[model samples]
Target: MIRYGILSTASIVGRFIAGIKESQAGEVYAIASRTVAKAKEAALQYDIKNYYGSYEELYEDENIDVIYIPTVNGLHYRDCQNALLHHKHVIVEKPFTLTSIEAQKLFDLAKQNQCFLMEAQKCVFLPTTLQLKKLIEQNVIGDIRYIELKAGFPGRFDYDHWMYDLSMGGGALYGSATYTIELMQFLFDNPHFQIDGSCIKCPTGSDEICNFQLKMNHQILVSSTIAMNVPLKNEAVFYGDKGYIVIPNYWKSNHLDIYFHNGETKHYDFPYQSEFVYEINHIHECLKQQLLTSPIMTPARTMEATHLVETLYQKWQEDTNE
Candidate 1:
């Protein structure tokens, strides 16, 4: 079994711990936090066999087959780099790095170390998403021309939260919009896209809302809007010449609806388990196959998403500066 070491006691870690409990191929072998008390508390809560007060201790443990990082967005690069350097496979949370350059560097390091590395993007592994991919590939939506996606929630975070800290890689583009960006990339199978957009920033300098238009090869137009100050439909729709597919809560979808111009409507339903389970299982399979990265959530895809986010943020910064 793959022995998994988690690098933080962040709230998100609980979801992954549950995923580990549900999977047969791996188990929570260790957990680490900046404080011994916190580490020990989490270890007891999860019944982990080993607990460390520092990430370095987990990295130095030879028995850990993989490391799962759910730390703050800003720390992802450093932690991932260290884990790879220590020869441990890593599964890092989304918004893998603050920039494409950092993502490229981490990917290169993983290659050099011959270790597995993946962005923990659980949405792409959802059964509904996989099914949607199949339908799109089968021309269920013929020759996609336009795509619209939006994700947002009502504003609730305080000023001091990392989500509002620019230095922490906090913004609607990175925190909320990334799901749609990555989903669009996965669904369209296109990494080459351009963005023209604008953003509204919070007082703390992080983006509160973003509206962007993307144009891909073949003149595919994708419009996306993400915000933290308002509630949106949080859905994605693909419009084709023959029909359209609509997925609600596309990021963690379990069902979809298809409508045709000819007045035919079809609905598909899927079982819903924690989406994390699918990602965890995919990682387990990749490890078994000795693969360096998951084909579903590839390094190229991660870089593409990072590049888009960085570009949008830069554009926002420049606009704000002037």
Candidate 2:
């Protein structure tokens, strides 16, 4: 079995471990945290065989073939770079890095080390998403012309210590933008796009709400709204000449509905125990064949999406004098 090492004790790590188990193609062999107590606690909680107080030890472990980084937004680059330098395959959680340059650098470093690397973008791999993709490609909706998404949750700064710190890559821009941006990229075959957007920051000077519009290929228009301090419909819609599609909770969606102008509606659902399993299993297959990069989650796609987010942040930062 491919041995996986986790690089954080973050709450999300538990879910990642569960996906690994469900994949059945890999095992959570080791985990690490900044503190021994936290590391040990996580190991026991997750049923991992080994634990380390520092990430370095886990990277050096001879048995661990891969590392999963679900660290904070700012640490994604550092952690992924460290793991790759040690010749370990890596799966860094989304918002892969704060900028396109960092994303590009990580992909280059992975190639240099001859190691596998990918962003943990679960949406593109879900059964429902894949099926939706097929339908779009087949023009089932008669040529998609516009896409819209509104995603957010009521998140307060008190509970999330790092979310308001820009230095820590905190903000709705980093926290919530990539999913919509990359989802557009994946669904549209990585089309050329330009972004125009703005954000309203919370009291702590972090973006809590962002509304961006992407002109895709000078044809399709993708409008996105992301709010971290408020609740939204959290849905993505694709409008076409013939009909429209709605995916509730597109991030971890199991179902979708399509409405046609002809007054017909279609619904679809593909339930699963854990959405993470598809991506985990995907990584398993790539590694088994000695592939160093994912074909679907390509480096170019990551860079393009990152560039979009960085550009928007820069624009707003200048306007707000940040």
Candidate 3:
């Protein structure tokens, strides 16, 4: 079994660790945190056998075959680089890095080291998400038109938490919009067409929310938004000449309703799990094929989607400063 090492005591890592523990081909063997107390506490809570006080120690551990880096956004680049340098496969949390350049560097290092690397953008692996992609490919909705997406929830940002700090890469656009952007990338396939967008920032000068309108090369237009200081609402609406598809709570959605101009309407529901077992299983399949990353979540696509977000933020920053 592949041994997994977790890089932080971050809450999201708990779900990922659970997924790893449940995977038949992998095990949650170790975890590291800046503080030994935190690492030991997380290890005990998650039943992890090995714990390290420093990330370097965990990366240096030869027994660990893979590292799951769920640290804050800004740390992803450095953490991933270190893990790859140690010759360990790595799965990093979304917003892959502050910029596509950093992401490319990590991917390059992974290639040079002959190790695997992937962004842990989990929604694409959901059964509903997969089925939706299939339906779109099958042209069940006819030619695609405009798509609308929105996902947001009021965040409890701790003053001590890295998420509230701009330098630490704290922001709704980078933190949450990564999911929406990646989903669009998955549905539309590469290059993602053109996206013209704007954003709203938090009092701290971080992007607290964003709204975007984009068009795919296939002539599919999309409108999307993400907000952190708001109630939880996640939805996506896909419009086509002959019909439309609506997915409510799409980030981890399990149900999809499709409507057609021909007076036909259908709803689909897929089983749900707190953790993404299918995504992890797909990773195992990629490993078996000796692939560096899963095709569905390719690094290029991740970079493209992530680049869109970074570009939006840059534009917003420019406009605000002007």
| lDDT, residue 248, model 2 | 93
Give the Å error, residue 259, model 1.
Answer: 2.4
Note the Cα lDDT for every prediction shown. Answer: 0.88, 0.88, 0.83
TM-score of each: 0.94, 0.96, 0.94
RMSD of each: 1.7, 1.4, 1.8
Candidate 2 minimal-lDDT segment of 10 residues: 152-161
Q: Of models 1 and 2, which has the larger TM-score?
A: 2
Q: What tens-digit string does per-residue lDDT give for candidate 1 at 1-322?
A: 9999999999889888888878877899999999999999999998898999999999999999999998999889999999999999999998899999999999999999999999998888888999999998999868888999888877667778998898897777888667877887787785468888888887898888888988887478889988889999989899999999999988888899999989999999987556688889999999999999989898888888888888878877888789
For model 3, the superposed segments whose C-alpha errors exceed 4 Å read 158-161
The candidates, ranked best first by TM-score, are 2, 1, 3
Residue-level error in angstroms, candidate 1, position 184: 2.4
Clashes of each: 0, 0, 0
Q: What are the clashing pairs of model 3? A: none
lDDT of 1 at 91: 95
Model 2 agreement with the true structure over 1-322: per-residue lDDT tens digits: 9899999998888878888999988999999999999999998888877999998999999999999999999989999999999999999898899988889889999999999999989998999899889989999999888999998777456635897777788888888787887787888888888889888887888887889999999999988998887888989999999999999999899999999999999999899988899999999999989999899888877888788888888898789875
What lDDT is reached at residue 282 by model 3?
83
